[model samples]
Target: GIGDTIRVSLTEEPEFEIPVAKIIANRYNNRKQKHGIKAIEKNPLHPFEYSKRASKEVVGIGGKNAPIVVEHDFYFENTATDKLRITELAKWKTDADGFPLFTFTDFAKADKISTQANFVLMNLSDFDTNWQDVLAKSQNIVLVFESKTEHSMAEHRRMFIELINNDIDLPVIIKKRYSAISEEVFQIYAAADLGALFVDGLGDGIWIEHDEQISQQRMINTALGILQAARSRITKTDYISCPSCGRTLYNIQETTARIREKTGHLVGLKIGIMGCIVNGPGEMADADYGYVGAGFNKINLYKGKEVMLKGVPEENAVERLIDLIREHGDWVEPN
Candidate 1:
């Protein structure tokens, strides 16, 4: 279904050559007509507000904290890998016996669970009619899910929707396990699965379990990247650049590279690099700063929606944009 939607959005009609924007609009309108207004009214919480509320109910994950990136301890059991030492690895809290503090138990076995542990981990299937009694003794609950089918994202989303409908505000750690896949495939699969959840404000943390083939650092970085792309977290500089076209006035690729090279360390800053001003402002409406092509060898810089400098020479635009950032007290020294 999604593949068809994507294909239609990119392919031009043979007869009329309809705009991509209009095609998307028509598709959206058709869906609305099919589902009716009740579909829109059924959402219980706004996406932004949903995450805010979910964060508050969990301990150590409250006070408006960004969604955390959790590292699984799969490496600890493997003695062959010395790539990341135990001391340097990012891990969860452990008991004095070197065991995890929380207990991971199946839903069927939860009836005999003890309250000695502070945290309890359960699968989506653990949620049942008597779930309230089973979880009543725990200080915190962490829901975990793993898909058994190709529609993993949808299954994860449905689990979240069930929680919201039942008013279960426990923190959820979106966990996915991978093996026998290339690093590139893992990256795409993991991002598509977890990013879908986070973008809709569904997850409280992310936990990726993988074989030793994937480095520990790569997993950590992928988790952070997914959160950053979802706008749920900001751990690095964010660049919003358009694909250059006939309207472009300069080498957009080289310019974007130069801009990123200088400002890549400025965490939380959003920079938009546009080939032209036609759709630049509207496209990057949420960007904190913008560098748009104005005319031949000319540039325009904007702070928010307001243009701070107009018709700046292309040679001096990047530095001027940096200066503008400093003037606004948003610039920090690169470490």
Candidate 2:
């Protein structure tokens, strides 16, 4: 469940964080999935598959590229050791290269930014002459925005529109902060706040800031998952699952989880798990493959719009789906 971006935090020496971050980033980067318009030419509606979006290229950020992940925060005092540390880390495309070294600075301190800085996090309320001058001067630096408005989506959208209208093409990453809540609520908020921008092709990347009670790994997973749900990035296997109904022949939730447990490693794969034939095939046609309920404890497997197997026993449905996936060379051994 890793991606090209990562942030490592440690209570120990900063050097200790490097190996941990590098190991995870390298493991995922090695399997780096190239996502772009060509990747989702067939059915762009499938959220798990790459979808078409009009996004500008942000070097090491967006545009058919994997979503970049970052650690919580990086504070800099502009010391020689800090410079040495940033140099030692933050190298793009390498094992230790995923964390976007972010430092929060006002216009006054922006000039003292170490060369090791990859992104500068700033608030929109602070946008002034000095900020514009900073943005104008640094053409290559990526800027991440934090909004003070309650309606962050609209605020972020307005900010983006302002930037575009002003001819500021600097790559922008959307920063969102969330309080610890139920996973379901967090997911909903994330989709509306961050997913909307990604869908409209407005953001180069996303950073989710959450309460300390929420684990960092969960935050990373949720960040990547939001990108996947928007059809902006593909990291893990996608599940186009349906809410069960009266016609449902099997437990949609359990079946979907079971299938995901097995095939989740097959990155970019879309698996549709529907409760019945009513809206199952028609709705999930965008998926690469489907598992729809027939009746009387039976299931029907499909490849796109075409049914591949019929009347398979309910117990055998998941295995059959895996077999079908393997038959198509999409299966990978779970690690």
Candidate 3:
């Protein structure tokens, strides 16, 4: 079953480990659920599935097509040069390579912006109706926010409510500024602040800033992780592996790691790794494929809940799993 929250911890340094975590966290982004046996099919116009709020299209950002990834930095100092930089950067494909850069303090510095600038992000605290007139002339504008603390989910919610009440339909990007903290603490902060907004269909993107002690890549991975958890995007493969216990038949930790190495490149695939029948097929509610330990040194493979192979040798399990994915036409060779 998909849990409300998830955290990935490792013995290696964050820089080395974040890539692996991201490989799993972003698996469900942009993925559509295939219809299975069901008593009723879903209506195309389900209220929760559609939003009346206006979708804004920025260069390289197609709005509701896919959530944009925003990055903040001290890219430009002079207002005159900022305009030139925007043009040069876009020409260089900097904005098109999945991340578009914005200056954190540019709003206070520049009265007018270049047409090449795709998004202007201002803190919710500084946001006012007067600026709306200025932004109305702009192309892409996003509301940037920083909540009070880890328990300040309501604070974030209020900001969005205020925006909607004012009829402001600009996309929002939640920004989290943090000091050196434990991965567990960061995960909680991200899930509560950014994850909550994405789940509510509020935020269209995320920007995470941290002290020099933290890796920038780690922040990007966490942002992607939050978006993935909210089901707003799907960029990588997801795993639904159970914790090992007394019912296990083989070395689950070793087996899971091996399985991940082989099939992790298949984006949007959900692979379940279970210890035994105690939490096998029935437990993997969202897994598209499953590997369950059937007995001592033996495994049962499933395509969803249906058993596909039984009592296969543990040595050949990973290969068999790949074969199953290939048979289902989900396999893609890694470049």
Candidate 4:
């Protein structure tokens, strides 16, 4: 059903390619029901976020997040007569009263624009203007940030702020398309109060590809990480368990996995597992419960040397950990 195509070769060469699709026609059941570029996306067992959504309209694959009940888009136009090219906002037009003239129709949206423009577009032709109209019509305008071909994005962002303080109707934000060196861009967008940030990094080419590994993971992690930072600031417990080393005298993997599996549902209780005694306790300093190999064929677990259980197979480790927590009433979340 995905019969979309894109012209691969520009000019007269006439090379065209089929657009990539999920290919499994019957795969998605809960997709946003609407077709075209704007579709409600789902991720299963994944907790991170993306770039494209710019607005959140569906819940993340992780059950922990709230549904993205709302979403929006930002559209820009090049209204300059000759399409001068400037990368800084300082070069844009100014009124007789010295008021800066930039493109965003809403001050809230203007704040979202970055103070710098690392990316550039040649004079956007009539066709480009129509394209912007298409995006605006197809997607709701949460904000609009304007730029002529000739202004530096950096200067534009500063001008946007200047406009806002000068009593402008704020768009949700103003931002340059996105660039490698725009930390200020991030700050402005974060301050815009957009509903959710869904990133579609696949479109950014060389700039994103240069740090593919990070760009790929960073998008989701950073969005969710903000929530994590807030959670950790006042949270109770965390756990870390290493895979069994070659020198592990006991079934450390099975034990660690089971322990984590059993206690994962518990909140505010830190647990650590070590394969050997050398670093087991030290490495688990933050844990309220710890299990480690005391010697060959000898294993030990203690709630502060209380010896909840010992000499158990890895399969039974989770049960033991659970029992220990129950015995001490440590598994309950603080009210």
Candidate 5:
């Protein structure tokens, strides 16, 4: 299965290329799923519980902190090449000696394990019973899983299940590496691969690495997007908009864009933009604010499920929505 391939030809150039590794990896992952792995019988603890159980407190990571994004040191230390400011990137924790506090090592290499690091990262693939003693000695250790197999997400899930079964509640970080793929494909793959673990309450943080082809900013945004989608962390405005249809009124797409342009800076706020009243109120039940089409050129604004204003002209709806956010003390001037 790992040797499978299909040929692709370009009509103009009369040249062909075969993506042997991609094909084999996809097939291998698919085949591995035919026989299901054991389900997680024990219900894992809430993310907050795991954080509190951590031996040491690290700001923005573990110990009642929201899940964090860990970027490569180059993005933070090498400011000359990376135009983005350090404040925009992930923050690194350092020891009193001015060295990085986290140590990443393969579990297979017993001699390489670090004893001084505050946060130690060990691979899940090379797990052995002998490492249990090492784990017991470390008070501030964080397991990091980077699956070598194509079916990585599944393997990560399996490792989490094993940890839960054995009563190990050490904070875990999901690590993924990508290369030789377009930026769009990388985003989709990273979200699906890492978001699944967060959805299961299995990971405490996320670490993403990509080849030089992808920018550092893109990688940071992607990590934040995955966390936001999982509902585990909130760093930006969240929008719930409906697909336009026959019943739609006003310019749904244009209105949504305009609303986002104004309110995108409102962090952790859920805004709903719906085409019509039929499904608007019901769909955005959890949204903080809602804008729905009340009539041909009229809009209805809502604060939660309750309607705060009705029959407002469509032209003035965006301004009125801003007023509503301000009235509730949620508005902040865009920086």
Candidate 6:
């Protein structure tokens, strides 16, 4: 019985139930299906991993991990004149008969360059073969998420659940790409017990950030931060927040942002934001601590409270929330 893994938004914070299984890409399966080779015609014990997706394959010895003889491998080359350095590097290496073989990244723009070099020309589908391109196999998955819009979350979850309920027997693990070093991609990775995840650039994405210029140092540091984080623990605070609703009387967005900005350095604190008192407390039941917007313009601080605190100016909500968090408890390290 594979348990389902889900990407939950702290903003929406909706609870879902299902079993998770991670998906593994099978290179050996590619060899068998694409090249018509038996997974092991010659050998009996080759330590092959099998695809859990197909039931027919599961009945016996041949499947996804069976070693397939690879006819080609890709080498990347950047062909612009600015990439003269690449040519310089390739000059040191040679193909069969001691002739230099060049590589290219922009294969789409490689009409003239393809003629000039000895290279394997391939379509995008070649590298992206299903059950082949991925690095490893596992049944369970995790998804990294920041706040997604409400309708987006629902539709996304529904689509994902449908994908999960597919006939694939293998556990499929899902994870979000480009989580912050401050966020808990690693924790989620460990919690979901993932075998591998997609490595990526920082801050949602480099392209997601504005194309505006900044200091080289800042760019390098952020990039390094992302790279280092993909391989290390999240050394800062983990934050969760809610996107605001019309029921929101307070500045939910601003409040959530300030909490993230201020406490982001504090590791493993569980804070929550709810829009209105009607469903806020019930919805935020799993939160360690929370603030809900109450009717009559008051705020309900869920620090074991029965009555609510009167509304302060919206401008001061973040400050007051910070003060409240600091006053409520000290930060604890995640084990």
Query: Which candidate number maximizes TM-score?
Result: 5
Worst 10 residues of 3 by lDDT: 76-85
Over 1-335, each residue of candidate 1 has an lDDT whose tens digit, in order, gives: 54444322111122333443344344344444342111222556564453543643443442356666666542221112322211211133322222223334443344433232133455445554466665555545545555544455666776666667767677676778878777866776788778978888877777786899999889999998999999888889998887756787988878998999999999999999988999878888999999999989999999999999999999999999999999999999987
Give per-residue CA lDDT, model 2, range 1-335, as digits (tens): 54446776432345766766665444334434532111212322343543343344544454455556544543222222431122222343245443344444442344433333356666655454356666554445666777644466756766666566566666677888877455545655676677877876667667777777777778778888888887777788888877566798677767877887888888898888888999889879899999999997999999888999999999999999999988988878887
In candidate 5, where is summed lDDT lowest over 10 consecutive residues? Answer: 81-90
Each prediction's TM-score versus the true structure: 0.74, 0.70, 0.69, 0.34, 0.75, 0.33
Q: Of the pair 1 and 5, which is ahead by lDDT?
A: 5
Candidate 3, 1-335: lDDT as tens digits: 75544466442334655664554454323122422221223322233563433456554333564565544452212222231122323433434432233443554344544454445544445444356565565656545556545433555665666566667767665666766665655665666667767776776657677777666667767877887877787778888877666788788878888988898788789888998987677778679999999999899999988989999999999899999999999999998
| Lowest lDDT block of 10, candidate 6 | 201-210
Q: List the residue pairs that clash in candidate 5.
A: none
Task: Supply candidate 6's per-residue lDDT for 171.
Answer: 21
- 1-335 in candidate 6: lDDT tens per residue? 33233333344323321111111112122233332211322322112432222211211111332111111121111221211111322443432221122222332222323222232212222223442222112222111112122122222233223333443332211212223322222223222221122131111111111122433344333432442334322334544355555788876766677767766666545566778877777666666567778754566675533323456555555667666666767553334
Q: Could you tell me the C-alpha RMSD of candidate 2 in Å? A: 14.4
Q: How do these models rank on TM-score, best leading? A: 5, 1, 2, 3, 4, 6
Alpha carbon lDDT of each predicted model = 0.67, 0.66, 0.64, 0.37, 0.69, 0.36
Cα deviation at 57, candidate 6, in Å, is 32
Cα displacement (angstroms), candidate 4, residue 213, comes to 13
**Tens-digit lDDT string for candidate 5 (1-335):** 63364443221122212343344345455666464545566745553343222323332245555676777662221122332111211133222332133333333333433343334555553455465666666555656677644566877877776676677767776888888877876886787688877776667778888899999889999999999988888889999887656687788878988999999999999999987899889988999999998889999999999999999999999999999999999999998
**Residue pairs with backbone atoms closer than 3 Å in model 1 (clashes):** none
Off by over 4 Å in 3: 1-54, 72-111, 116-139
Root-mean-square deviation of each candidate, in angstroms? 8.0, 14.4, 11.1, 19.7, 8.9, 16.6
